[model samples]
Target: MTDPPKAWDAELVGKWLERRLAAARHDQAAADRRGYEARDDYDKAAAEEWVCRALQSPDCTREQAALARRIKELIGQDDYRATGIYDDIRFERHVRGHLRKLAKMTKANEGFEKTLRYQ
Candidate 1:
């Protein structure tokens, strides 16, 4: 019988998640600076779509999936109008919050190996 694929280590998944989140945030920031505003419903939809794609990608681990889900939810909640001046700021805040959570997860997983050694 064929063996099942091994589950990824939480620490490894956390690192991968961190990298993906950073890349996404950087891309969004660059786009924002270029006047590619995300204040409209269409833009929000596109952002949510991108998050959904990331979540469904084969490269996404469990940790990344969870983070992506939160990002998608944030995008859904964004009510910024095209006339608003704080659209970019609000979006950045959401991204930063999620990034912080990703960092925390990475730190928490750092000692995972020690605990598993006893198991």
Candidate 2:
């Protein structure tokens, strides 16, 4: 049997990667202008802010911010070998669990905010 045709051509893939790299570089430059010492610092700060918003909370607690940073770190490592997971599937599942936890926390925080508003 003949092998199937490839879904993506090399040129197309290269162009896609180039666009992504360019966007990443632009973001890095903006972060530098904003006084972030490193790209990771900028990413962590953004993640912390996202986490706080997802939780519907006014501010991120130290632990919540840490969790957000951890999530970012885990995300950059695409495989189990780097993240200590047994397999890729497990790694994705782990990340999904963390996301679910964030959602739940957000719901609880929203309720708390509502309670405060009512009182």
Candidate 3:
């Protein structure tokens, strides 16, 4: 025979649920951090590869090559302010964006977009 069920402890159940939710939130925060770190590493590696290819490619124009070199130098450095340009920029994204625009205008056939695709 089965034993009779005990009454539910409302206060105890509430405290348990609160702890569970807190743990879930903490886990989510950790996961987000890991995702961000992974993306950063991927971007860095990709930027390095693209810079190398751009520097070596004959199809890359002089201006594009110069921009690529600059981006390569700035990849691991802290963000800086330019004398007459935008203030407080994320170097990688900013320089990368400029290189992309220049490549588009110059109709570069080096497959810049494919090189930086985040898989």
Best by lDDT: 1
Q: After superposition, how far is residue 29 of candidate 1 from its true place, in Å?
A: 1.6
User: Candidate 3, after superposition: displacement of residue 77 in Å?
Assistant: 49
lDDT of 2 by residue, 62-108 (tens): 23344345445544555433222223454354445545554454333
Question: Model 3, which residues run further than 4 Å from truth?
Answer: 36-119
Q: Give the lowest summed-lDDT range of ten residues in model 2.
A: 110-119
- Candidate 2 clash pair list: none
Following a full C-alpha superposition, what root-mean-square deviation does model 1 have from the true structure? 12.7
Q: Given candidate 2, what's the lDDT at residue 75?
A: 46
- Candidate ranking under TM-score, highest first, comes to 1, 3, 2
* lDDT (Cα) of model 1: 0.44
**Candidate 2, superposed: residue stretches over 4 Å from native:** 1-6, 37-119
Whole-structure CA lDDT of model 3:
0.40
Q: Kindly list the per-residue Cα lDDT of model 3 for residues 11-113, writing each as its tens digit.
A: 3323332343344344434444677544433343333333334334333223444544544554445553333222223335744653454344334323332
- Output the worst ten-in-a-row residue range by lDDT, candidate 1: 110-119
